[model samples]
Target: MAEAASVTTTLYYYSIFTSPPDRSRTSSSSSVSVRRRNPSSLSWVLRCSTNTSFPWGCDTDSLENASALQKWLSKSGLPPQKMGIERVQVGERGLVALKNIRKGEKLLFVPPSLVISADSEWSCTEVGKVLKRNSVPDWPLLATYLISEASLMESSRWSSYISALPRQPYSLLYWTRSELDKYLVASQIRERAIERINDVAGTYNDLRLRIFSKYPHLFPLEVRLPAMDGNVALVPWADMLNHSCEVETFLDYDKSSQGVFYTTDKPYQPGEQVFISYGKKSNGELLLSYGFVPKEGTNPSDSVELSLSLNKSDKCYFEKSEALRKHGLSVSQQFPLQITGWPMELMAYAYLAVSPPDMRRNFEEMAAAASTRTTSTKDMRYPEVEEQALQFILDSCETSISKYTKFLQGIESLDLDVTSPKQINRISFLKQLAVDLCTSERRILFRTQYGKRPGPGSGRFTDGAEILRRSLRDMRNGELRALKILNGFRKLFK
Candidate 1:
């Protein structure tokens, strides 16, 4: 995700243009419109994108960047490898096996010298010295380092690597606020996306106020990559590997080789595409970080968020709010709901929300159980509020389903803003992505209600957890004493 931007017309266009070969960091004539010769290499796959259009990087379908990156890495001490970058069906462009890659065989011995980190030498010495002096974190430092090197073009050692980065990485960070609201209106993921965008904006503003404004010439607005994956570092050839929901292997330092590599969990034919795991990420998570959503039911870890709120009319509202606040929760909370199960914590929160005055004694305990911070879990059941808890969840599920139903039925009606063909294409593409995400998410909610429609006269409220005949227990985050996870997917069969 190298944002190789030079001076732009506006401060926030966030373009990824390659500057002139002159390597001047402050030249006004740096931003060019033509494409450069992309190098060959086993460059990593940058799974991110942008909403604001400016020609920054090449198309993912093209192999010019990959080829260039490969040549550079090969000459720069990269070991012989069984895989090389190729056009693929899964992640657009990914590492494909050049030979029979076997299960358990470690791959991609990307040398330590090639990996980019905070400690990597900056092309701009002044920028590096100033950033380190301020005690910047690893994420922003690496982002700044990559941007600085990128601005230097061929003069910088990482020129080939920078050239390989996607001009527009496809993360939710790039999605416009209006787009998120209109497209992802049905799911709670919209909230997460908004929060993430705000976080990036906030970070950018903070840095501009503290550092970038003072050294504008050295740091030319790298707002995209920093918010991405605080836990991650930029790996070389390993970045080319695309994510598969099935694969359990991930890129990590191999102490034996003193470099980064991932062991193959599954066998691949010579021509087959190689895959790696991003994490045990849900469909919503993949969409958040990487723009793509997994096809329906293919991702075993796929899940949707279900939001639950305290009944304001309840007499214990103030007390419950205080208790939840102490445990770092609020009156309204979100829990992940999967096709197979729901977390026990969801049940605990629901119970507390629906608990009557008679169960006042256990309010604190229930709130504590709901918090992930609670090390020793306390699983308590209130038979008196059990039915109420189950109904509460079903009601919430119904409410969510209605919103999805409204959007899915006539999604095109929401695209009235498009006047030009370009705008139409953009809006339509975004709509399709939204439809895919919403459909997958709504599918889970639909399964939970046992064919229950949104309004009154819907199907009979299905049992939840122990009380929820099968749905609640089916989707459990873990084993529960009274029931299992909410098997929301099972609702479809009914």
Candidate 2:
């Protein structure tokens, strides 16, 4: 089996659209067995099954829609599958194993014609012409196309697929501004989500002013709204699968077959909800884009971004700012803190930010080198400089943690019974995500501050550094244990 790290990277490598295709193509002529459909429309029913070990709920309408879509895909040249759509506790609707499947089995073979890509030709030719001529980037263009097709409803070629889509996606884009402010005030994800929403609106406005407004007939007002949150592509039945940190399956276009295919990395049993990684996204990222968060401590790729800047009150602030500017870095810069630790660039920036006048001459060299190389907190020396830098990071992380803690406390005091269940769950996830991020970041800072060894200790002369290190270690372990306990308790409610 592929290691989880490499598998996560593979998922990303396949999902990105780097360039437009020259022409459309078709897949093999293989056929899959299709279940006979009832003439009567399936009722939109939400069934909660208590028999499953995990909480399982399904909408009959969605499953019916998925079944129709599968048949359409098969007729359109999709190869046979051993997987079928089912209700899943993790993602509402997901692809589940229909039978025992082996590793390296081909789960899906989506034809190029069915695969939505940047090069997809739009039904509205005039609008497509303008977009193509102007070279609108792939992501936004694809998003626009998806909305355009969706607006047509039953008339669309992808009507069944559209019907199968989640009516209420849990993405941050769906969160109200008030909700974002209340729950994600301290998270860096909130800023990114806001920026993305603004960008989508901006892109739509620009298109309207330049093209749609003039050719009103081609682009109707009903279809002019922005629908995309960020980079996304809709793959019919393939998208129904939820994300898993353990699975290595990934969707990618195969030039040889002229279709999109995903291979299973591990064996799966019948009735198991098979999953594909939506890349190794952080909990915040997963929530922002997909509307879900992995269990606490399970997401290995999780990280939190911290903003750092030199204090204006410092005597050498001007010098440091100038040095940072020379290296294409702003005085205020962001650094990512991962579970393992932080990058060398953070330490270099911290060192430069607090370096004295005598060390100022070396700033340019240090800044240049930092940008090109990878450094860790352990690798960073200069006790005086690093101490200040680590302290700044520690303080920032603590402040963020405090903000989340206050919000969580405020929510706990409120009458949550009055709120919608969905809203309650979203708030709960956001609070936990904030706590997890803060905990991971603090661990790194603690390690930086107290991980170093002290000289030998004598009787009645134990080194203060060793004592402090042991204390920090114990505290870190306790924090992790508390997080685990809290997570376990949360699961009980589910």
- Evaluated with lDDT, which candidate comes out highest? 1
Q: For candidate 2, lDDT tens digit of each residue in 1-494?
A: 10111111110011112111112122234221111111111101111123322211123336777777778888877777888876677666667899998988876777767777666777665566777687765555664565556545566777666556443333566566776776677677888778756655676677667766776555543222343332234466666666787864566556565556677899999999887766666666666655556666677767676677788887788877877777778888777655555555765777777777787777775565345332322344466564455556566656666665666557555436647896777566655655554455444434434443322221111122432335445656877999999999999989
Off by over 4 Å in 1: 1-6, 9-55, 220-232, 416-419, 450-494
Candidate RMSDs in Å, in order, are 11.3, 14.9
- lDDT of model number 2: 0.56
Can you give the lDDT of residue 264 in candidate 1?
A: 87
Candidate maximizing TM-score? 1
Relative to the unseen true structure, what is the C-alpha lDDT of residue 409 in candidate 1, on a scale of 0 to 100? Answer: 88
- Which segments of model 2 are wrong by more than 4 Å? 1-61, 222-233, 369-380, 414-494
lDDT of 1 by residue, 383-440 (tens): 6676668778899998999999999987978878669997787677678778888898
Worst 10 residues of 2 by lDDT: 7-16
Clashes of each: 48, 1
Model 2 alpha-carbon miss at residue 470, Å: 6.6
